[model samples]
Target: MSGEMTQGCPPTPEARAAQRARTLARPGLEAVRVKGRLRANKWLLLRRITQLGILALFLAGPWFGWWIVKGNLSSSLTLGVLPLTDPYLLAQSLAAGHVPYKDALLGGAIVLAFYLLFGGRLFCAWVCPVNLVTDAAAWLRRRLGIKGGKTPSAWTRYWLLGFTLVASAATGSIAWEWVNPVSMLHRGLIFGFGLAWGIVLAVFLYDLLFASRGWCGHVCPVGAFYGLLGKTALIRVTADQRRACDDCMDCFAVCPEPQVIRPALKAVGQAHPLILDKDCTSCGRCIDVCGKDVFRLTTRFDRSES
Candidate 1:
C-alpha cells in the first residue's frame, strides 16, 4: 500500500521545478529585451554627439596652434594643447623671473562648479585624458572578464602631488600641463606617429572592447587631487541607513572606486548614513547599482546621513 501511494505521488520535485521554470522564463526574456533596447538608444545618441564635437575640435585645432600661441589672456597667454607647451610656459615664466603662488591662476572655477554639483568627479568625467584611457582599459578588462587588484600601497598618489607642485614651482606651472595625459594624447595625435600613435590607438581600441572607465580608479593624478579637495564638496556619493544593510556589500562591488567604497561601507551606521571617504570621486556608479535604494549623491557633508 505504501509503495503504491509513493508511485501515485510520482516526483513532486520535478513537477515543482517545471512550474518554476515556466514562471521565470518569460519575465526574464522581457527584461532582457527592454534593457537591450534602452542601451542601444543611449549608444546611438552618444555616437552622434561625439562625432559633432570631434569635427569641431579638428577644425579648431589648426586655428589655435597646438604647439603654442602668443595671446593676451595674461595667465593663459600662451594658448596651446600639447603637454610640452605647458612646460614651455613654465620655463618662460621662470625666465621672466615670476614667483609661483603669488600669481597662481584662480581659474579652477569649473572644477569647483562640478564639485558643488556632483562632488569631485566633474574633472574625471569631463577632463583628464588618463581618465579617458583608463576608462577604456577598464571596459576592455570587464568584457574579457579581466579582474585587476588594487594599486600597491607604496605607490600612494600623494608623492605624485608633491612632485607636481615642485615641478610647477620650478617650471612656472608647466609641470601640471606636462604630465597631463590629455595634453600628451593631443600632442601625439597632432605631431607623432609610429610608437606614439600606436600607443594612443591601442588605448582607444581597448576602451571600445572593455569596461572602459574602470582604469580611472587605479590611476590618474589629477583625479586624485580633485578627490582630496572633494571632501568638502557640496555633492557626494552616500548611502542611506534606514534600510536593512546586511553585510550585502552590493554597493561596494559595483563601485569603480572601491578604495573609497569599502571604507564607507564598513563605517556606515544608524547615526551616519553616507560613506564620506577622501578617496571618493563622487562618480555615482554606486548609487546606480544599489538594489535597496540606500545610495544617493546628496548635498550634505555628513556621510552618515545618506
Candidate 2:
C-alpha cells in the first residue's frame, strides 16, 4: 500500500461490459439465424436423416422381417446380392491369422473403394449409430455449460488402433468387438438392450462430462482406421468463401475436429481454401454454423477460393 496500488474489490465497469460481450459471443445456433435456420441447418438435417436411415435399413431386416439388408454394421449382405464388410474388422481378422471368406474379401474391397473416394470418416458422421449418442451428449454439454473435464491426445486413437490389431493377433480373434460401442449398440438395437444400454450410456456420459470429444475424437480405433483411409479422399470440406469470414468463431466451437479448419480458413498466402486434413469427419457442422457461408463440401481437386 505504500509504493503500489492495491487490488480492486471488484471488476471495473468497462471490464464488466467486456465480460458481458464475451459471454454473448457464444451465440450457438443464433450465429446462423440471420441466414435462415433451415438453410443453415440443411447439412445437419441431412446428416441426421442419413444416420437414422441407415439404422432403419438394418433394423428393418430383423424387426419387420424384411431382409433389405441382412447383417450388422460389421458385415452385411444387401438383398442377398450386395455384400458389405467393415474393412477395419477384416484387417483385425487378417492380423489374427484368420482368412476371410471370398465374399467377405469382396465386401471389404467394395467398402474400401467407397470410403477412398468419399472420405472414410464419413462413416462416423453419417452412418454409425453411436454418433447419435455422442452428438446428443455434445449438445447437452454445451447447453449445460459443462466444459470438458479432460482431453486426451488425438493420437491416442492411432495407438489404440494399433493395439486393436496387436490384440487381435495375440488373442487369435477379433478382440475389439468385445467392447466396441458401435458393435454393442447395433447388436442391442437388433437383439435386446441389455448390456448395450450400459455401453451406450457410458459413452454418453463420457463425452458429456469426462471430455469434450473423448470417444470418436480420441479413443475409437475404428475412427482412426477410417481417418487414415481418408488421407487422400476425393471429397473434402473447403472453406471456399473464407474471405467472407467475419471471425465469429462459431464454426470452431461446433467442429469436432477444429484443428482441421485453420489451415484452410486462414492460409494467409495460400491460394486454396480446401480443408485437406484427414482427421476431418466431414460432419458439416462448420457449414451449419458459419453465418457467412464460408465453408462447403467439394472435391479436393476443386480448390478455387471464393
Candidate 3:
C-alpha cells in the first residue's frame, strides 16, 4: 500500500495533446494529397453509386409502382423476364425438405453462374444494403479514436453457416431468415420501418463500440457462404504493382480483409503477386487508397508482376 500512489491523477495537457495528434494521423491522408482527392476516392465513389443504384431499382417498384423489379434481394424477377434467387436461400429450402419451383432452380443457377464467373463477395461489396451501415460504423470508429474491444474468431461464421443449414434440416424451416438482417432491412424499406431500424442500429453500435469489422468480417454467415463460392472466382485484385509500393499500409487499414493483402503485396520471392484469398471481397478499396497504385482489379489468370 505504501508503494502505490495515493491518488489517481488525470492525464497532463501535453499527454492529452499527444493522444489527439496520434488519432489525427488517419490513413490515406497522404494518398489523398498525392493522388488527387477525386482520383484517390474513385473506387469508393463507384461502390456507393452501385449500392444506391440497386436500392433505387428495388425501391422504384414498391414506392412508385414502376415495377422494375418484383421482390427483394433474396428472390426477384426483373421485368417479369429475368429471375434471380439467392443460392444460399435455395440451399436452405432444399435442406428443409422443400423442392423449389423450376423458376427458382433456374434463378439460382443464373446467380450461381454469375458469381462463379466473377466473384461471390461482389454481392457483399456492390449489392448488400447492410454494407453501407457497417461501413459507416467503421468510419466513425476510426474517427473517434476507438481501439480494440472484442475480436471474434474468423472461423465463427463458417460454424454458424453450418449450424443454420443443420437447423433448417432439423426444424423443416429456413431458420436463419428469422434473424437475417438483410431481409429484414429490405422488407422494412418496402413495407414500413419497424424492427429493421433497431436491428441495423444494433449492428452499427456493435461495430463502432465493441469491435472493428465485427459483423461483416467475423459473424455474417451469408458472407461465409459467398466466400466459399469465391474460392475459384475468375476476377480478383492483384498487387502486380507492388514493387512500386512505398509501404504506406493505407491499403491494409482500409481493407475489410487485410489478411489477404500481405501474401500478395509482400511476397518477395514468390512468382505471383495475385491476391488468391477467397475472403478478399474484391472491393477495390486498396486501389483507391494506394498512392503508388499498387493494387488493381484483374483476371485471376494474370500473374505477371508488371
Candidate 2's C-alpha runs over 4 A off are: 1-31, 268-271
Cα lDDT over the full model 2: 0.86
Off by over 4 Å in 1: 1-106, 109-118, 148-150, 170-173, 186-215, 241-250, 268-271, 301-306
Question: For candidate 2, what is the TM-score?
Answer: 0.91
Report, for every candidate in turn, its global Cα lDDT versus the true structure: 0.46, 0.86, 0.86
lDDT of 3 by residue, 89-108 (tens): 99999999999999899999
- A best-first ranking of the candidates according to their TM-score comes to 3, 2, 1
* TM per candidate: 0.57, 0.91, 0.91
**Candidate 3 off by > 4 Å:** 1-25, 268-270
For candidate 3, list the clashing residue pairs, or say none.
none
